[model samples]
Target chain A: MPRISKSDVVNSTLAFITLILFWFLGFWLSHYIALPAALLGLLLLFMGLLCLGRVPKPLEYVSQFCLRHLSLFFIPPLVAAWFYAEQLGNNLWLFLFAIMFSTFISLYLTSWLGQRFFGHSNQSVSQDDES
Target chain B: MTKVNTVDWQSIIQLVSIEQLLWITITLFAYGLAIWIYKYFAHNILFHPIVVGAILIGCIGVVSATPLQDYLIFVRPINWMLGPVTVALAIPLYQQIRLIYAAGSKGLLVIIIGGCVAPLLAIGWLFLFDFSDPVKLSVLTKSITTPLAVDTTNIIGGIPELAAGVVVITGILGVMFSKIIFKLTRCDDSRAQGLALGTVSHAIGTARAHQIGAKTGAFSTMALCVNGILTAIVLPLVFMLFG
Candidate 1:
């Protein structure tokens, strides 16, 4: 099994604090624009990382933990959606049609595009790396 | 008839005020049960974590006569953390910058087309159904990951909850049908398969893609981050201009 790199308590806590601070920064920016605070936080952090030209070890370590358990976080929202279930149910066919049809189309289009445009080239590059 | 009438959903409203701890335990346990099921079964699509956990929790609520509002009081903290986690998504995105650059204009073009056109197609497909403007707007963000989709949906005057629900559906359905879609489209390349999964299905798609292979997972994650960030950036700006 591959080793899991665990950050110490201090680094993880510091990383959490940094993320909260960035979230606050993004929240503040949202008031001046028509966007979500978290997304602005994401964009700001993305730019910051681009400037640094590297992801900090602590941030990467901590974020992976958060992302791994991301599904658990969503359970409440889905359950709470019971209140709106009536509306969703009424439009169930429309919802399913749009969601399934569009998703299939996009997946099909993207896979075809990716294969047609970059398949051979990417394969060659990986082959070179292996050699 | 008297027993049935007296035991209806409304009666529970006055019967008891359940503690938050109980609900939290139930939520966590449901999630644990889902993990156990996956470990034993080696199946994913039919039993996606969110679907399983949420359904179990919802079932518990119904049996306990607890409304979703009360359940929310217990799990609101989890929902609130989504914001910080959204910020964390940038970490993986940052890690991918080099790979994306190395992959060049071709990768960029694929991500851009997949990300942009997929959501638009959803909205176009919505034209067949006569939803309100706000309902129609919600579909715009459904192709992205949930947090970004919810946030973007809110900013664009759509229902954030609806956006989130559809995002999950998109993820599950995208993975569920990917095999057939790829074959029909003649997209035999593994890398492209991963990219399509991540680009259209978001997180759930990435998880399924990872199950396929590590290289596929990497490309899927790459597509996920780029598509998520791109939609989050562009959708809001486009709505701002429209208004």
Candidate 2:
């Protein structure tokens, strides 16, 4: 009984087409151009969004969509790692050490510095609440 | 005349086989259709179309015995665009200059500490565990986004492609879980949230932070840019020293 909003149709269609178009464009650029496809994909995304107007809700929906499903995009690449399994197999110990070690280090350092820089000292609290 | 022409007709027919052409067309059409279907069902979660399409393509590649490298040749064109897109991130950094200025020395200090510390921690931990050179190099760049991570890895004598993989994984994990970690730790302020997300997750984390609030996004963007530059300079130097 309700009429379809023109804006909704346009936005949804744009959203749907943009992803495929960008994917193909990224593939084409990566193959022919000397640039990385992810960078180009992002550039086209920004430009496309700009041209699509400042409709906050649709844009928000699109971004949320991207965030939630970020992992799906990388599945192909991850599976590609299977092809290199032989090489990785030989270097299994090294890979394990690297992933574990680096993850811990990044986690610790970020948490520590994050605490120090943004950490709430008594002075910061008093200064803020004093005003 | 027919008998004379028949002598070469076989070779001509083989050169333009309908079956082979039809197969190629079908593959291309299938890929397009899969992507379209993925986009339609994304529904703003882990089911996003790009992710689904990637999974489908990957499964197809495995099932068909297609060499991942050959498929990459097709995907590489899209992958190459990562550079300019990174440069474009600078626009947001420029826009947030006023906030950066407002936070002033304190903000600069926070960025500096985060930028310098994150890579150091990753590299140092890898070394302590005695990881191989390539793996070490890959992990060193994990705190950044894919494009920059690849470039940084290449410059630092690591495998760029491998680095890209690590960067993607790191980003996914960071984006998905950092918020829960933050909430658990009771880090509720925008500044702290931005710093934590940016420091641990990199660009994707920053995108997540942006969703929380403007200040958080601004700070997260700053963290991404500053950390990127710092890691670019510092990681290579550290690698030279220990690597």
Candidate 3:
């Protein structure tokens, strides 16, 4: 396990504040337009980084940390499953079937489409074996 | 278990409610434990941390008769911070774009098709079965990331909570059967494999893609972002015109 050092704390704090600024800015902008605040913030950050031509070290550290544990954030809304109990119970099999069926269809469709669009490029095939 | 229940959970909730920090710590600890279980139990995707943690929290809520709103309140900070976290996603998104300049519009085309196809198929399937409009709308948002799902659901009059739940299930199902799908289809291109996972499965699929390899992770990240942004922007407009 890698222990977080003092510098780690400082860097994450800085990264966090930067993200919050973007988040706030996005929220403010979303009032004028009709985009999701987070999406707005994300685009702003991306464009800002594009201008910089590189990710800042602190931002990189924070983003990696957040993405690694992204699943944690989803758990709260997932508790809504309890609220979904009544509807899910009545259509349990149908619900599962629809979700799984649609997922598989989408999954295979994308995979096949990916093949059609990207599969022919043998030069980039080097990525296949390395993974 | 009976003795555990003997303690007045109501009073405990009241006491803990006074100091929000206590509940937040407990919530994080539950999620951490869920991850530990996933790590120790042969790493089965079946016992996904999201699933297990939700179950644990549900149990606590049910046993105490705490409403979902209260639990949400207790853990509100986590939800509040999601804004910055979601914004932070752009770093990885931007970085991946730079890494895979060769993919370019070809990659975007694949993602757009996949993103649109998955949701349309889901909505059509729901219509065939005569599932309610809200369920159909929620399912339409299922293939996107959770945050985007919430936003899209809100736009289309779907239940955001249900949309979030459906998104998780979709992602898990994506990770669950990806290997079989890959083998049956013989999709050997890393870009293709990653794009399929990211576009169809969203963030969860991207996580699985990362486990496959660095190149795959890069492509998957690109697919996740492009597919999400496109879906978020285009779906609402389509609904306005046709819904």
Candidate 4:
């Protein structure tokens, strides 16, 4: 096992607290606003705080690690979905076809427009790519 | 089923909460096995861990006669973690702010087009098929990430479960097929590829972008965030106007 440092532990704890705080904020706001909007609102607030406070190294590490492993977080809902799978029994084919078709169409159109208009001239775009 | 009801099983059940422990262990083991399978297969898009993990878990449920309600008792913690995980996305969005600015008006245009057309096309076609309102509403937010898609679906009076499932399906399709689409279009620009994937498929698309390059991942994150916010706000309003 890799050695765990005290600062790393502190950072992870702080990151956990930050996420919990935003989760509560989202819960509170979900009563008034849509849940997505409330969650997004909380995310933006977190971002603003990070900027104003100058993100700590530990927070950065925790967030990036969490984001990279984001799929793990989705496992619960995906599994819970088993409960409602039967609801989709009707028109399931239509749902599948429409979703797949529209997704491809959206992908094609967005990329085409992005390629034509964006052109990747900006230095930041190049810098990120190189990194 | 016989195995579960066997005399030997009765003794085991009396000794402990066999059903709860069995389901919990099965869920975790399924996820681990799925990841191993995904890695063994070289991360083939079709072998996506969630898809395989769900299948494996479902099989266990069927074979053992374990009810979904019973399984959920042990699985709900993983479900609740989604709230904090959703908030965790802020870190990436914050890091990618500079690139978001660099994409500029072009990024805005792609988002506007994707954000509007994705739902319109999905819902319009479903309307023609005469699907119920809830089904149409469920599929409308299919292109966004699951967290945002479920929430948006909830507010718009759509079925959250259906929305979540469709979102995952759309994401898998987007990741699996994007290679051919990108090749046919000769879309060499990483930003464009990332934006397209992020807009259509959300996190899975971003994961694919990461595989291709860092820049693609960065731009994809921007696209994911923008597309999510747009859909979350736009879908409900559109529904209100024409629902």
Q: What are the DockQ scores of the candidates, in order?
A: 0.48, 0.16, 0.57, 0.50
On residues B10-117, what C-alpha lDDT tens digit does candidate 2 reach at each position?
Answer: 787887556445434434454466556746765333543334555666677678777767776545534433343454443454445455565567666666665555
Measured by lDDT, the strongest candidate is 3
The model with the greater lDDT, 1 or 4, is 1
Clashing pairs in 1: none
lDDT of 3: 0.82
Question: Comparing candidate 1 with candidate 3, which one achieves the higher TM-score?
Answer: 3
Q: What are the chain A TM-scores for all the models, listed individually?
A: 0.81, 0.60, 0.83, 0.74
Question: Which of the numbered candidates is closest to the native, going by highest TM-score?
Answer: 3
Give the Cα error of residue B121 in candidate 1, in Å.
Answer: 2.5
DockQ, candidate 3, comes to 0.57
Task: Report the Cα lDDT for candidate 1.
Answer: 0.80
The residue-by-residue lDDT of candidate 2 on A1-131, one tens digit each, is 96769988798567545555665675477566434454445456556655754434544445445433334334444545445445777566665445445544454445455555666752442222100
The model with the greater DockQ, 1 or 2, is: 1
User: Which 10-residue window in model 3 chain A sums to the lowest lDDT?
Assistant: A122-131
**Candidates in order: C-alpha RMSD to true structure:** 8.4, 9.0, 7.3, 7.1
Model 3 per-residue lDDT tens digits across residues B1-243: 454447777887776566377657767888999999999986678888899999988887788788887778788788888888888889878777654567877777788888877777777777777577787788887788888778778887888888898899999999988899887778888888999999989898988888888778888888888888878877777887897
Clashing pairs in model 4, backbone N/Cα/C closer than 3 A:
none
CAPRI classification of candidate 4: medium
Q: What is the per-candidate TM-score for chain B?
A: 0.88, 0.73, 0.87, 0.87
Error of 3 at A55 (Å): 0.6
